[model samples]
Target: MLKTLASYIQEYKVPSFKAMFYVTLEVIMEVLIPYLMSDLVDKGIANGNMNIILKTGLFMILASIFSLIAGALGGKYASIASCGFAKNLRKAEYKQIQDFSFSDIDLFSTGSLITRLTTDVTNIQNTYMAIIRACVRSPLMLIFALFMTFKINSKLAFVFVFAILFLSIVLYFVSTRVHPKFKKMFSKIDCMNSSVQENITGIRVVKSFVREDHEREKFSHTSDEVFSLQRKAEKLLILNSPAMQFSVYVSILLISWFGAHLIVSDSMTTGELLSMFTYTINILMSLMMLSMNIVMLTMSISSAQRIAQVINHKSTLTSPVNGATKIENGTIDFENVYFNYGHADEGYVLENFSVHIDSGSTLGVLGATGSSKSSFVQLIPRLYDVLSGSVKVAGKDVREYDLKTLRDNVAMVLQKNVLFSGTIKENMRWGNENATDEEIMEACRLAQADEFIQKMPDKYDTYIEQGGSNVSGGQRQRLCIARALLKKPKILILDDSTSAVDTKTDALIRNAFMEKIPDTTRIIISQRISSIQDADKILVIDDGKVLALGNHEELLKTCTQYKETYEAQQKGGDFDEQ
Candidate 1:
């Protein structure tokens, strides 16, 4: 984990080392000031000589200023290094996520990945800042001060050994007890974030269902779990302060008592005892700071591991090194395919799914809710690799083509149509960034979206609200279809994308596809039998197996399920209603 995290510190390494350098300089000056005070008291004050006193006092003043400057520089460098390192880490994690396949995304989940990127990364950033400055300075000050105290009076210094031993035991107890709680606390935090994200994104649904109170209760439960865990961890960590202060005071009191006796016996001078007190305080205070930093490091350790997990994870799918870049046609072939999500024990979402879609032909897919109709089309663009067989596009295994090349040639309008917040023209360009205004209007015309767009106040320039919330569901679906059409892909898969629009509009869009883009391989997945009755071929699948493969009239005679669905829909007369 450490190795993985440290790699993100690339360009910030110089600032990290500079922080250490300044901290070292600061510690050296801090240690020297006490020694200078000893000389001023011993040689100058004792002899009542102003010259020696002035010289030592001036040297101490210069050392104090230098130490302050070093400390400021150390703080500046630590901030730069830590913040830069965090930027690198976030950038790397985001890049890795962009390359992830659908199966890879399912592994971590959206909410969990968001928590790792934000809360976890922030924790590690603060810990890194402390490590570069306090972590470096504390041990240096502790060792240097301990050495000076021993040089002054070795017998009195043994008091510190006892005090150090005491503090070490306290640190051990606090660290061991607090670490486990901190791990649990972070888990609770992730849960809380997930709850909050879900509530905010789906607030409209919550209100529609009158479930605000339920959401509040759910969020409160997660928040209370986090608060309780944090309190417990802090309760243990709070023990460190009193233990540290107790050691500091007891050690100082012992030094003062023993040193006063040594001075009376003429074994040690008053000046040396004064310096010993100063060095003792330095040693104990630095240890206190070190203990606090150690606790923070312990807390951030789990965060670091979480971050490393994302940055180091390899996506399950990647294109071959020298993969094909050009697609010959829109033909799709699924050869003895078996696929699942996350793990195999979950059972195959689509098993032994085989199909051969001819180029420039229309194929309609029909299935019930869990028949994996969407999963079958998703394989064409290499969204998820099959477990045991190959998905081929344009006569080559999807994996054998460059990911961008394959996806660009195969446009998929998912069951849940999505439109980002932007101007209508800008969003339309998502399918083709360089698409001209005339070209965009043409695509919209084919998708039957131009009429409503022209009626809008701003027409092509109108801004789309998030998720296209400002527009009706039918309008959003039409806009998405227009955008997909702009891709001008060899293969176009509309996965129940027209479910929101009226049957008349749906028929117009299908007719437009047949007329305008005749050579494109069109795969339409729809529930409305009227939508697929005219297709060149219709496939009826159930339980991951094909029930029938023929045109509409052929399927109505051969497939009982398809015939029943069509007849039921015709009798009900409102399957097209949104």
Candidate 2:
């Protein structure tokens, strides 16, 4: 984990090294002051020499000024280095996420990824800043102060050794006990974030169902779990302060008592004894800083591991060494494909699925809820690889083609319509970055979206709220369809995308596709029989197998399932007339 995180410190190496250098200089200057004061008290003041006292006091003041300047510079550089490191880390993680396939994403939750990117990264950032500043300063201060104490009088310095050993043992014990709790606390944070995100995203549902109290109770439970784990971790860390204080006070008392006896025997002067007291405080304070840093480092170790897990995750799907770059046409063929979301033992979502779609043809897919209709189309773009057999697009195996080249040729409007926070024009531009105003309007017209967009105050330039919350469901679906049309892909798959719009609008959109973009293969997945009844071919899928494959009239005469579905819908609403 340390090595992985260290790689992200790409450009910040110089500033971090400079920060350490300045902190070292500051510690040296601080350590010299006490020694100089001891000399002023012993040789200058004791002999009634005002000149010696004045000169030594001036040196001490200069030392203090330099120490202050060094400390300020160290702080500035440390902040720069740590913050830059964090920025690089976040960028790397986000870029990695972008490269992940759908199957790779399924391994982690949205909430867990958010926590790792945010809270965990913040924790590592704080720990890194402390390492560059206090971690460097404290150890140097402890060593220099101990050297000065030994130089003044070795007997009292031994007292510090014992105190240091005791404090070290206490820090080790506290840190070991607290580390596990911190790890558990971060997992709980992931759960809490998941709960909060679900509630906020589904707030409309909660209000309509009058389940606000239930959501609150669920959120409270997750929140309390986090709070409880944090308390347990903090309870262990709180022991550090009292243990440090006890060691510090005991060392101070031992020094004062031993120095008094030494002064009486002429082994240590009054000035030397005073310096010993100052050095004692300096050494103990450094140990206190070290303890605090250790506590922080312990917490960050868990965070670092979590962050490294994300950065180091390799995508399961990779492009072939010399992948194909171009597609011949929109033709798609699934040859005896078998697929499952997880391992093969979990059973296949699409088993032995075989289909051949010719270029520019319209194929309508009808299925029950769990019939793997979406799963079948997903294999065309290689969103998830087939477990066995070949899924070919334009006469080349999808895995053999460059991933970007394949996906760009196949446009998909999934069952759930999503729009980013931007203007309607901006959302449409996602389909084709270079699409002009005229081209955008043409696609929207074909999708039956132009009328509604013209009704809005700002028309195409009107801003869409995040997730297109400002638009009605039908409007959202139409905008998504228009966006996909903007791509002008070789193959377009609409996975129940027109469900929100009225049947008349759906028929218009289908008709527009036939007239405007006749050379593009269109696959429509819908539950309504009316949506697919006019297609060149219709498929009836159930339990991951094709039960019927033919045009609407052929299936109605030969297939009981198709006949029954068509009759039921026709009687329910007289939909057959349309």
Question: Whole-model lDDT, candidate 1?
Answer: 0.91
What's the lDDT for residue 122 in model 2? Answer: 93
lDDT of 2 by residue, 306-373 (tens): 89999999987887787998888999898998889887677888888888899999999998899889
Per-residue lDDT value at 247 in model 2:
88
True-vs-predicted CA distance for residue 571, candidate 1, Å: 1.9
Candidate 2's displacement at residue 415, Å, is 2.4
The TM-score values for the models, in the order shown, are 0.97, 0.98
By TM-score, the best candidate is: 2
Per model, state how many residue pairs clash. Answer: 0, 0
lDDT of 1 by residue, 447-492 (tens): 9999999999999999999889899988998999999999999999
How many clashes in candidate 2? 0
